[model samples]
Target: MSDTSDRLLGETTNERRASCQVAPGLTFTKIESTLQDGQTRYVRVLSVDFAAFTGKIRATTGKTVKDRERTSDMAGLMASQGLEPLAAVNGGFFDIASEFSPGALGGLTVADGKILNSAANGEAALTLGNHGTNLWIDKVWSQSRITFTPPGGSPSRPDHVVDGLNREPGRIQGCGGGMGPAGENDRNSHPDNLIDARMPQLGIHCLDSDETIVFTEDFGALPFLPGTVRAVLVGADRTVKQVSDTTSGLVAGPGEHVVVATGSHAAWLQTDAVVGSQMSLPAADVRRGASAETAVYFNGTDDAVVNGGPWLVKNGAEGPFDFNSGTTPEHAYLTPMNSRTAAGITTDRKLLLVVVDKKSGPAGPAHGLTMPQLAQAMKNLGATEAVNLDGGGSSTMWVKGALANHPSDGTGEERYVGNAIVVTAK
Candidate 1:
């Protein structure tokens, strides 16, 4: 089939699959096929730049309420406005003041931040900060975005603000606060169950176990050749130990892959090449050239600024980036920024985009997208450079009422998470 035909149908015949061109400088070739439970699975060969995709997790709101019914009401409020619930509701909901709030975990909060006790266990709220921290309570008839400074000292224990959201399986591990059960020191433990941070080396089992290989990031390394491996996962730490030498070295480039072990066990393998490929608007077209200045905006305006540095807009469009209203599960109305956003500014000018897969409604699931499905969906979308962001209970993708992705967790429950990436105009 021709590229145009494939783009339209989203699939191609076996004969044409070998040389399918999804995007510029990206190609998909058939690798292998497998049948499970009477289902046929075909693995495709991917080629592209891995550095183009990066990941990030940012703290949005901190403290919130601790009311279950109020949290449920907040979910309905989000649904009515076309936003996905950020917390999970088991029997309860998330409460910002519930000792497990983001403020408790990261010691970060805004004076007039948005709060929603929409998680399963308690009430949840999301605040919008100003220059510093800001707090806002809609339920309390508050509007103006306020700002404040974070508290002085850190808390002693881990906060459980979004515990109800954490219980849901497939939810990213590190939603509510710090790395979930897997603390930062435990390599064998899961690294906060976020799609972007979900390192295969950190115990995130691949859907197609045969196609996935885990590796550590050795900054000082060369590129691995294609066709020698399937999919590759980079370690969390930015460093990798040399193959024959024990000396720790920096991975040469952002894209180079290396090998890493979890708790003395070979947890993941990495390749010094692109593990996947993606179709991005050219830097020139996106106005992300070397000379271009980076700008950030929230809610489609430049009024709400987070890190007002240089920005690389998609397709050269200033301010609001276009939404992917395409016919794919990965497509959504609002795209959240991943660590790639940070990397785009510091390293390559590439943007990591994500869509919240959940619905709005009092009767909707609270959680966002699951890990396995997200990984597979990204693969299917031809993402050569993709990483999972924080999802589940804390999986919130809100845009004034035009729902973007499907919420898998279901209604009246909110999912808690460590952080999130938001877009606001200053």
Candidate 2:
């Protein structure tokens, strides 16, 4: 840890009321009030200033679906890494009812600087940089693609990017890769969702400039290999210049960045990707999903972004919304439903995570806020820009190793989820 990280980890300010230094530049504020309806609501807001601490603030997905840990149990995950759980909230949408749904199952998911799953166009998404710095929220118009070039040819950006990194966890609870997990191909087989047939399951496998694959399978049946996988090589040109069917070790030259994708091949092979020749993947056409567009998320070397709908607040102005539209937005941006979650950046360039708690039951106080109310609440909090995240029963927050709110699941339990935005002091 640098001086900044040290200062942030060690600094404690006890002078504030209902607020304290949860992390370096991070502050926790709780707002409690009783409404005229005799309902009491609880709101815990995390305020972060990027300047104080010296580490990283990230939105990371948990283990793949089959081997998933309870997302509401942020403390357990934090303990596994020997980290302090500053705060955490569920992430993205997924095949909630399926046991075989893969981890980071749906929406756009990029963890630890790797693009594990691309966003669907029209869907909302959040993108981030590798260092967990640059942050963006926007409406994703493109899913994902692979553009590559051979030894010497105009950039050959392929039309398709690999669909995923593994089998659907919702479809097959223990669909491990290799000959061991026989149904790996059978789970979640779609034309769009894909994993390399040879690699077994799908995932984002990283490689350094030297083309050294740095990944080890945690749950899937596939064994870890340095270069042999569904890997794409990014070179000095910063463009993916090559795609390999079986192994990145064969395609990547020394000193190149590598990325490996996993998913079912039944869906991915639809792209007709090639390797011997030159190729480059251009942004694919944006497709609309059942309710809205599928979102995209990315972790670049220096920025992060997630997008959905028109800007809620930018430069301190509310963009647009219709409280009485009598209909939900395509992606439910302004839904009046309760248990809404929002991520934002303050005008002063700080990070904000807000979860509006809904009244748990007839006896609970806060029922949660609607679209317009949620947006306005963000504005009042001084958020210059923000975007809505998956909520409803998915809306739960964890701090210091415990759920900080009443989960609407009624089971008094954390919903087992595909992914989560985990903030840590590591």
Candidate 3:
């Protein structure tokens, strides 16, 4: 953003100064509600100078339940990371109420550039990555597609890109598959049932591509080649968004073929795919109308990156980000109320981590702030841009082995989670 644009955030940088600075750019402050009845209602806020500590602020899914830790015991999991945090919070929605082994629901996640989960096409998202010189929040889009046009024939295309490479039978409505099959109502679908699902969704990862594109499902300690692999036909709409999903036996003839798999269009999409030749799959959301080479004619795969969110703030003004609205009876349901955790950027280029304790009182501001309230609080903190992370029982914060917020689970208790955002004193 330009200097003049930064000034538009109302020049409230450091509006509520931190009481202490423990690291280079990490500071902590205790904010009390300025209301008469808000005497007992307060929040713990942490601020980081993103430019000063570029690459230090990050989002993480601490550990995968692998079934054992459907919710990795939160506090225990944070302590295991070994990096102290200026403040931390639960991240991304998860499979807390799903048929599959619980973990991060659809929040795209990539640590060390290793693809853990990929966001759904055009889903609400928040991203943080380096622009070479500085690590800053980014706006990235995930597009799912496997396109191919046969010789002198029509083309076949799939609309969604699913994460995780598990053909685990039984699909949940809005769990890992995303808000598509769920039909727009963010909270309407039954967590454990499959309603309008596309059958045999094609999965792609680097492994599914030419050996030239290395697949790094378990890229531990390995120099990641994220850009090297343009798009991996990782998994279908099942488990995680990052690896090779169950393949729908693509038996091929030496000559040519074309196929398209869409859940909403038809139950079964069968066609032939020519061996050694598919359409070229390219990156997404890079520019307006700039699509990956969709006509590699079945020669492709799309990228999966970052976590999901209901963007709270943007470009020095309120953003139009929502996960709930316009439902088709099949995808409308009530959303749960709980504590909230959010991330934002200040006018002066600082990063803010705000965690509002849940509503415990019978009602009113005495209870915690609702999503709208949280957004206002972020604006009050002088944030020019912000996004909501996973919250509720999953909401948490850690600092040098000490828990900062009064976790709602119990008196100073915590709920295990699939992931956590950490602050290491690099």
Question: Evaluated with lDDT, which candidate comes out highest?
Answer: 2
Ordered list by lDDT, greatest first: 2, 3, 1
Residue-wise C-alpha lDDT for candidate 1, range 66-134, written one tens digit per residue: 112222344444445443433221111122333212212111122122121111100012223332222
2 or 3: which has the higher lDDT?
A: 2
TM-score per candidate, in order? 0.26, 0.60, 0.58
Model 2, range 228-342, lDDT digits (tens) per residue? Answer: 2355445534455556654413323443434454443312321332344334444333332323344333325333333233346656776564311111353344555578677
User: After best superposition, candidate 1 residue 223: deviation in angstroms?
Assistant: 50
Which candidate has the top score in TM-score? 2
Q: Report, for every candidate in turn, its global Cα lDDT versus the true structure.
A: 0.24, 0.48, 0.42
Candidate 1 lands at a TM-score of 0.26
C-alpha root-mean-square deviation, each candidate: 22.3, 12.6, 11.6
Mind sharing the TM-score for model 2?
Answer: 0.60
lDDT of 3 by residue, 322-405 (tens): 333111213211133357777787878776777767644223433355555566678877888777766766667676566666
Predicted structure 3, TM vs. truth: 0.58
